[model samples]
Target: MWRTIGGMLGTDLCPNNIWQYFSWCYSFLPDGEIFYTFGLAALCWAAWNCRNRTTFEFKKMRSPFDVIYVACGFITYWAGLLMGEDREAMERGAKMLRGNAANMMRICAAPGGVN
Candidate 1:
């Protein structure tokens, strides 16, 4: 499952390598960055719902695809509510982070500093 998603994203999507997954997302999802962010936010919401269902209702775990489908629905609903300026702001932030990512990585990777 992860291997296929990773292949499509051009990076590893394993739990231990989330930084790599995010890096790939930042670099590759230029046009779709806002949409991707929305999708991920919706996914988090969906996961929380699933968690509550499991803990409180004792429901069986949902399939991964089902979770994703619900997230997509949330994204669609949220996208309808998001203003154009909100999306533009998100795009600007993504571009600014992309522009400075190399410098930030260098600073974090340097010796005698926090890793």
Candidate 2:
């Protein structure tokens, strides 16, 4: 997933280093930074919600796919509410991130992944 995102954004990010991620996004994706921020925020919120549901409601833990699905929905809905010339670019970036997330989920579900 990180590889796919880095490829799309034209950066080589360190998976364990969030500072590097932020710097890379801020530098390379200046135009689409808001979308990236929103997407990450949504992902965090979704993960928190999923954690809460699992803890309090005794619900099963959500898969990576479910979390990314929620993030994509949030990004799309939020992007739709923005008004600017860069809105299209934002949407495109969000969609690309969403697609990458889906692809990562597929890879994670494959034979050598965390079955």
Q: Relative to the true structure, how large is the alpha-carbon lDDT of every model?
A: 0.55, 0.68
Give one clash count per candidate, in the order shown: 0, 0
TM-score of predicted structure 1: 0.53
Give the per-residue lDDT of model 1 (tens digit) for 1-115.
Answer: 2332344345555434556656656776666655655645776787788778888999986454445445545655675566787655544543443334334444545387556
True-vs-predicted CA distance for residue 22, candidate 1, Å: 3.0
The residue-level lDDT of candidate 1 at 43 comes to: 60
Model 2 alpha-carbon miss at residue 33, Å = 3.5
TM-score of each: 0.53, 0.68
Best model number under TM-score: 2
lDDT of 2: 0.68
